[model samples]
Structure formats: C-alpha cells, structure tokens
Target: MLQGAGVVSLSGISTGAYATGIEPFRQVVTRYAIRPNPAAPWPAGLRLRIAVLTDIHACDPWMSLERIAGIVAATNALQADLVVLVGDFMVGQRYVTRIIPAAEWAPVLGGLAAPLGVHAVLGNHDWWEDPDALRRGGGPTASGTELTRNGIRVLSNEAVPLATRAGPVWLAGLEDQLALLPVRRRTGRGRLGLHDLAATLKAVPDGAPMILLAHEPDIFAQVPARVALTLSGHTHGGQVRLFGWSPVVPSRYPGRYAYGHVRERSDLVISGGLGLSIAPIRLGVPPEIVVVELGAEAVA
Candidate 1:
C-alpha cells in the first residue's frame, strides 16, 4: 500500500528532472456537465455539448503540438457549441519570451471554432509566464503576435455575453488568483484575491444564466448564489498518482475537488485538466480533454 504523505520519485527524474523540461503529450479527456436545479423540472430537453480544456501548460514539446491538435479535432467531432479553456495556457519563468513560441504547432491553440464561440481565462502559469502583455497587448511583441494571430481570446477579469439557444448565457473569466496572492511565500507571485467574482457578476445583470471559466476551481466555493455553473481545471487530476491517491496538489482547495467529477452544490464541475504540471508523465491520472454534455438536471 502506498502512503499519501511520502515523496514521489518517478523514473524520469533519474535521467532528467522533475519539471521534465518541455514536451507535449495528449490525452482525450471526458467530463459530465453539471447544473443547479433550484426548482422543479430544470430544462430537460435542451442540451449543449461544452468542451472544457484546462491547464494546457503549452511549452513547446512538453505539451505537444500534435496533442493540442488532437484536442481541437476531438472538440470538433463532438460538435461542441461552446469551448472553455480554464487556464495554464503556457508556462515558463525566465524563458517567458519562449512561453508560446512560433513553430509548426503554433496554430494549435487558436484553431478551435465553436458556433457559440470559444471562451478562455488566464491560469496561474499563464499569468506567471506573461501577465501584463497578454492583457494590454494581445500577444508578445517579439513572438510576432502568434497566439492572437491564430485566434485565441484571453479574457482577464472580464465578461462576454454568449448568445445561446436558451436566451443568453453570460461567460465570465477571472484573473489568476495566483496573480493576486499577497506575495508572501515561495510561490507568492501567482496569488490573487477572489474578488473578481463579485465584479464580473455585477457586470452581468440579474437572471442571466452565467457560466464562468476559471483556471482554478477554488472560486467555485466563493461564487455568488446566482451564477449557474462554473468550469475549472488547475489540478491536473493528481498528475502522478500511486494506486488512485494523489500525494500533493499545488492548489489550496480540498483534496475531494482534486479529480474525476465532483458535484459541489449542483453548480460546479472541475475537470482534471489536460496537461501535466511539475512532472510530464502521468500514471493513474492520465491527461484529459473534457466533453461535458449539459442537461437540464444538475449532475449528482
């Protein structure tokens, strides 16, 4: 039996390192869509396929161009009307310039197309790699404006009205909580206040069914009562687990919210994410690209 509190040492670490440099690998992810049913008969017949992809951590080979391409292809096949990228789009510290480089795979992130439109928010990694630039400017100046040139819209603490068949679904994206942290610890730079929720909600009037795309699911507990659904994926489903238990997760949330599908009060669904965090190889927790079929009843 494996203890949940011991240090995990994988084979790759001996030959290489824990971070695993940067390489791309893909995993086809699946997830169930959840809704909050406050009253009788939540819209039963109406349905929508929402593709949720979180934690790309795209750093060239680490998160393969081929894999990202596969994700886009999968999303198209599912005919997902709405696509949500929760966060960790790119990763790198000093090599921020190379965070999202130009190569044959440069177009993967932006190739996604949905009738309801693709929605995304910045993750801790994205903010750490390149924050101010992805905000004021669309893309890095030196990179020849690649990400935006391809078509990915990075929303930071903002809201966009999505015209859905069922009236209008308001889509909101929050800035990285890691970005707002008090800068007191080893990883202090990425923390941010959860106040973005209130501001974004205020922007959307009353009675609009709103869906939020946040990199971290920690916000789920703090979201206003009216927000219908929230999608997140920063956990990476416990990237390398021994016998179904993950020893460590970087986030501050509870371990129950770490993997699979957890129904939190019927309004939250957090994907295990699609990429690796510190370790490139995954064990029990393979990467995923979630296809959530949203139905009338809340997923339980």
Candidate 2:
C-alpha cells in the first residue's frame, strides 16, 4: 500500500509536474455545445462562439510569460467570436521559483483577438492575495487594474450586450463572489462576496439571450432560470480528478461542481482551468482552453 505522503505525491506532485511543466503549457481546447433547458428556453438562432481561459495562476516555473503568450496564440487560432477570462490572473500558489508581475503578463494577454472583444472577471485569489485589495476589500486589484490597463475589458457585476452574427445577446460578468478575504475582521468566519446577480442581470434587456461569467461554480446555486448559461473556473477540477469525479472541490456543492457541464435551474460549465493553486499540481485533469459554442454550433 502507498504509505506516508506517497499517495499525495502521486496524486499531486508526479502529476503536478505535468500540471506545472507540460499540459498547462499546451493549448488543449475542449469544445462544448450548450444545450439549453427546454423549460428555460434559450433564444433561438442566437449563436455565440466563446473561448474561455481561467485560473491562470501566472508564476515563473509553473506558468511563465512565454507559456501565457503561447496559449494566447492558440486561442486566437481558434478564431472565437469572443474570448472570456474567468478570473484569478495573479499567482495562486506559494511553490514558485519566482513571481511574475501583472505588468509582465497583462501585455501578453492583450494580444488575444476576438471580434466581440476580450472580457474578464476577478477571482477569489485575485482578492485574497493582494494585501491592499484585501484591505480595501475591492478593486482596483492587481488583476483587475492591470488587465484593464492592458486593454482587456474587466467586468465587475455588470452586463454588456454584444452584437453577434447570430444576433444581439447580453454578456454579463459578476464580481468575484468571494472577492474579499476577511483576514482583517476577527469575528468573520468566511470570505465575503461582492457578486450581485440581481443588479447585474438588470442590465439585460428583455427578450435577449444572456451569458454570465462567474469565477466560482457555487454561485450557480443562486443563478436563476434567466441565464442561458454560466461559465466559471476555480475548483481546478478539485485540483485532481479521475473519471470525471473530483474529491476535494472548493465549493459547498463539492462533487457536484467537479468539472464539465452542469445542467440545473441555470446551465453552468466549469472549466478545469489552466493553472493550479496551493501547489504546482493537477492530476487526471490537465489544463484546458474551453470553447463553448452556442446555438446551431456556429463555430466551424
């Protein structure tokens, strides 16, 4: 029997190398054809092809500048209509040879091309890791400020409608649900959330199809039937998964939020994410570039 930390090593480090060294550096695009809840009814003929990259815990040895650039190039090659980043741009772990500053990674991500434009949201780590942001309990976080400075649109609990070839659709991005870490508050037991789903959805006009960008899948519980789909990444497939089952997910839903497509009151697709957090490792689940195709599979 595997003893001591051998099992942990096997599940985390042995594969962690790939999570850190190999797979994440590669552009492994996984495509999904969203099937709307018949009862909820997605707008007919409103197709959208979106490229999603999330949890890019950009560090030196794990996720270098060169790696991010390559991923950007690969995503551009997909020719997606819109590219959405689901947050956690800053480094997520402490096992790094060196820390890559936002200034270094932001410009590289600015190269991402999409007709509808590149949009982003903040993640829990983006707030938890930044002292000033954690103290202020809000932006301008490094990921938010730097990403915006580089010209990538960072959405904070706001929605915008984009004109697509299929039709016009509203795209909303929620503020990170766990945006504030209560490190300063002695009595608070959990992190605070800034996400306002109701206010954000208010921006969507009636009769318009909508897509929401959220950092954590747990928020799906609060998501209503109005949203055709919700995209998120944070659990990193529980940072190690086997046969579509992740044992240590970071959400209240645990196993239910493992990875892949979730069909509930609102449809949610949680990407395995591109980088690891807490450690430089990812097991059965490799990094991925999620390509979500809406409507009649408009993406060729």
lDDT of all predictions: 0.64, 0.84
Measure candidate 2: CA RMSD: 3.6
Candidate 2 positional error at 67, Å? 0.2
Model 2, 1-300: lDDT tens per residue? 568678877776666567556765555788898766655546666667899999998998888899899899999999999999999988888998888888899999999989999999999888877889777667788888889999899999899888876577788999987776556365476557888988998888876778899999998988888788899999988877877777789898996876888888878899989887987767778789999887654222
Q: Per-residue error at 138 for model 1, in Å? A: 13
For 32-135, candidate 1 gives per-residue lDDT tens digits of 75555453123336577788888776665565577678778887777788887787766533432234444343477678889987767766665454545434
TM-score per candidate: 0.77, 0.89
Q: Flag regions of model 2 displaced more than 4 Å.
A: 1-26, 39-41, 184-191, 297-300
How many clashing pairs does model 1 include? 19
Using lDDT, give the best candidate's number. 2
Output the lDDT of residue 135, model 2.
Answer: 75
**lDDT at position 251, candidate 1:** 64
